[model samples]
Target: MTLYQKLKASGNPQAVAQITISLLESHSVKETAKILGVTPRWVYKLRERFRLSNGDISACIKKRGPKFRMPNRTPEHIENLVVTLAKETNLGSKRLALFIKNTFNIQLSPFTIRNIRRRYGIHCRKHKTLTGSRRFATDFSAFEPLQLWQIDAKHIADQSALPPEAYASIFKNKLPPFQFTAIDIKTRLRFIAYADSLDFKNGLTFMLLVAAWLRAFGVKHQLFFQTDNGAEFGGSAGSRKRKLIQKLIFDHWNVSLLNIPERNKETNCFVERSHRTDDEEFYALNLKKVTSRTSFLKMAQNWILYFNYRRPHFGKNMNGMTPVEALKFYRCFYHPAIGSMPVVVLDQLSNYTSLLFDISSLPWDNLPRNKKLLNETMAHYRHSIFSTSL
Candidate 1:
């Protein structure tokens, strides 16, 4: 038995108390044993342990052995194989545990796999360190409104994080769940579309939807569309056809292309971080409500509406303002043409402008630094535009 187990299994609370007092008092070993009603050998062992730990009582209680135990009673060779697979896949703990169960018939919980990952350097952080030589980084802060956009897709598994009926629908051949996301880097405006499959065709369709939506909203701005080296976004996919995305960005939308470095997902950290936010705030909470694909689609649409207009974001540019507020602020502060455009554009933005829409009303210098974004969120005060649900 380990030292801690042996010490705890003895069930002698008074013994440890006596040892602590003895160490603090600098009592002799004989005096400590007599005070604690234990043998001299036990006192000597405790003293030795205490001295080894440099007078730390808590460290003295810890057992000297391996910290990690393989999950699901997995064999050593199989555990090694799991680590190897982790090195390749870079999956999260629960996904890695599921992989182990499906591939080797070993049942491991997410917590166990997390411990195993911490024990050995098998996590994706190690993957980042592996390629820590040199690479370019994206500055999500440096872009102006409509200066850059990011688009990406996320996949929801067939039988993961759903109810029983949701589980029963996997009949070996069906369209899986996927979501196409587009984000404006400056204002953090997010648009999302759900699809059954991931392809360049879907990428084109989503970009067209974004362009059409922007056109309908009367927004005219040049931007660069950026994506990683994924096959979906016309990257280094080895001749799988990328002309659709190229035409969608360059010809139709008139946006430049910002290609991310190979194997460096952190370069696209904004959208990637937002995906985790969606997973936690939306997907995990709505698992029970999602009964079918249609319901899932509706959920995604509503989430985008909330994300765009309701949710408050805080940053250097978007301090204490929603995406809509941030967008209005940038346009009002930067673009005189937008202010002088047709009354329709002014009307759509009037809800976000201060009373009278006068430049004199702008308290840019009078207001504190933190309150400078206030004039942008003020409406016409005649009606609340966001009263109706999207």
Candidate 2:
């Protein structure tokens, strides 16, 4: 390649301009053009710019495009609005455009929104792209709302998800240490409950509460709860205790407990993914403000309400609708109550039940009970029981 061609190929405009200026001092314009692989007229223009700018090599660099902004460019105010909304919502270009159009009656295209985001250094988080085979492998189109729910537990004291003060406050204030989460695959509708412990009793209580909440809303379909093979849900495969727990759920509530394959988390991806959202959008933002168990529960309830009824989701099956909106979109297949399921404190419910009936009176022969968990639960509720008696 020619010297100029090589300089240009280096993708450095400053280097190209300096080299062209250095060569112009010793070589004729025609000879310079020949060596630099350029027209004599182009060389003459660079020399003139160089002389006009008092021998500044930067002047020799060709300026591309129009000197003035395009008349059709987005208005400054509109671009500012897009940037503000992008920061506030962290929505992608397409969704931001749609939101802008719907909220403000503006007609900005996604391309324009994308450019504004790029210019402002605002970026949306990019999710991993699923392979075509894996993408189409599990078809959820045929699933109806309330048919399949993915349930999982999230440790709320995680440092990665909570601020330092919030993490410390979790222990200092004696807040619930675990969050039990359940999300429907069809509508992305979710329910959450907080607990002080991560034991079989709490897990069973969470499922029972969720099932009862759904049924109260007039849901008639037989529901399925998919969970990981965590000891909380049930022990690993072939454990007799796991079978009995599954049988208990089936017999009492007609809700089937399905365990994901051993060591394969992808099967419970729906609820697993929602845990990250809880960390980013819910816990991290509000946990720092929590001062007590009651305040934390209230904050959690508000977050769940906003998530189900107000926040828009752009997941694979959601199509940019909030969970309630998605449910409404499939109104024919969903009960209205499914959209408004309440969040509860699992420990409180378990404690309330324990107060009503002696723990030993219930069926416990077949299931292996944790003595430490049982004693801790009773002791935790002992104060409430004494207060109620007084």
Candidate 3:
């Protein structure tokens, strides 16, 4: 009900009028509503009644201010600065604002910088390095480097507080380094580097670098690059990368282009999970000290190399081998069977990683005649499997 209605219902009209006047004067509709135990709309109605009763108050009340203003300087220049800085270093609002203030002599609040970002609709995202939920994870297994590659990019956080040199030179321009990473799922060899741009050229260069690294390490196999449908992975509709992969890679190698469905593509689950090591080992220790992108990237590269070659992946096999060892072991002399499908146990997860083998690969003579036995054969691998709902 309106405050007028409330007052008319109340025995004390003068007291209600005084309280309403106090609330309108103080702009404390929330407090007044709580005291009166009424909605703010009722308070608003009271203000409108009083304003209508006194024409002088309505005529004197000023108009509300504008929500946005045309930026004093060129917005193009600021956008360029923001994009450059975000790419070179992952410094968020407070630092960006302070950097502008100290270096360019332009005093900007963090909120203003956020507004500037919103104005242009520039999004800067850092994929989280850890996973508490397994919803986005993928299921794939092939025990060699070229069998499959999981790819993604991460923005490395700038951990250092404002240093004099950084404020003077780098921060003045708003340039930060971006980290692009690709991981071979089977062998777990990582291709990680800090780059200034995330363009098609960079994507091609990253792939070439991985191919070169594999060749240099005497790793030879038909490569199957599996990645999300990121812009970098595939070019714009009917673009060069799309043509290149279709005409060249697919025609040449035993390529398998696997991607998470669009709905599940938001999180880069496998490689993102690998970033936990990047955080615990690299960023956590070095963030307090390093400011230069060059220095930080060098350290990051070294750590990633060590992780791929030395660090043991507890998830690969029940035998507990590093990814390299497991890949080599599988490649050299492992064979289960050729008839029906082999029972590949997934000991770690409660769920099944069902294999749909090519019927063409096996002989018809040894194949299962009974569908029930085939289903039971697959189920018997996992002790916890309750049904063949898989």
TM-score top scorer = 2
- lDDT of candidate 3 over 116-207, digit per residue (tens): 76766655544333334545533555345445677665555434323244334434333344556667665555666555555544544455
TM-score of each model, paired residue for residue:
0.48, 0.72, 0.43
Best-fitting candidate, measured by lDDT? Answer: 2
Alpha-carbon runs more than 4 Å astray in model 2: 1-47, 50-65, 70-72, 125-137, 161-169, 333-337, 354-390
Candidate 1 clash pair list: none
What is the per-residue lDDT of model 1 for residues 116-217, given as tens digits with 9 covering 90 to 100?
677786656320113344533657567767568787887754344434443344322242467677777777778776555566445655655565556555
Cα RMSD for predicted model 2? 9.9
Model 1, runs deviating above 4 Å: 1-142, 158-175, 236-249, 332-390
- Score residue 237 of candidate 1 by CA lDDT: 31
Question: Which of 1 and 3 is the better model by lDDT?
Answer: 1
Q: Could you tell me the lDDT of residue 67 within candidate 1?
A: 90
Better of 1 and 3 by TM-score: 1
